[model samples]
Target: MQLTDDRLIRADTDTVWRAILDPEVLKACIPGCENLTGSPEAGYEAVVAQKIGPVSARFAGVVSLSDLRPGEGLTLSGEGKGGAAGFAKGSAQVSFAAEGDATRLTYTVDANVGGKIAQLGSRLIDSFAKKLADQFFERFQAAVEGPGEAAEEELAEVDGDATAEKKGWFKRLVGG
Candidate 1:
């Protein structure tokens, strides 16, 4: 499957870039994500429980980011095994541009699935993928917006903490 889209984030490009790289934010945004570990340098490992049509499975995989251009863009790629449910692999090229106080994020993805997942109707898989992507971006946008003032203040307090720990995948996805 192929997917392409863009979103406007109500935050500076640098802030949005940080949020995207934060594992905690990713974990929070990914649908049904159970765990996410590792750093950007080593790639992230994750276990996610997902249901597509009549198939429900726990997928374990490694997600990596490369071709980074600082606060501009990067490439994301990953492959996961869903046991009997199937397997999936995909890659996306992402770009970011400054737009006033907001940041514009654009992405183009190419994905493939095999085993039972491939046997399932394409419509089902397409819809599911679209839904998951939409959820991820929506959550990301909210996170970049800083949500409430208290949250923004907290982020500010830790802005230069340098000692901050790597967040979980959930945090990275949901921007928590």
Candidate 2:
């Protein structure tokens, strides 16, 4: 599947660049991302749990950045195996630009799947992929700017240090 989209982030281009490079921000923004480790230079290892249709699986993958252009753009690519659920690999070419006082972030994605996931049909997979991409961008915007009403309610319902950790992560990025 191929998808292209963009959103205006309530942050400067530099700030958006920094947030894209931050592992914490990436971890928080990715839907169902249970754990993400490593740095931008060395690539990242991620574990994500997701339920698509009736298939639920835990995916382990490595994501890396390439084609660096400083504040302009870069490409993100990753592949994961979900045991019986099959495997997926994709790449996104992301671009960032300064628009007014905010940043306009755009991405074009190309993805492929095999194994049991391929049997799920292109319609289901395409819709799911679009939804996932939409969720990622929305959550990334919230992470860089501030939590929306739904995020606030979700944060309120979640107990303990998760919320605190998320807040601190954002603060650490913004504070410096």
Question: What lDDT score is found at residue 143 in candidate 2?
Answer: 75
Q: The CA-based lDDT of model 1 is what?
A: 0.80
Candidate 1 residue-wise lDDT, 1-176, digit = tens: 78999997766788778877888777887778899999988899999888888899899998898998889999878789999989978777889999997789998877777899888888888878777777777777765663445555566577865344443333354554
lDDT, candidates in the order shown: 0.80, 0.84
TM per candidate: 0.81, 0.85
- Top-scoring candidate (lDDT): 2
Point to the candidate with the largest TM-score: 2
Predicted candidate 2: what Cα RMSD to the true structure?
Answer: 4.9
Residue 40 of model 2 has an lDDT of 94
Clashing pairs in 2: none
lDDT for model 2 comes to 0.84
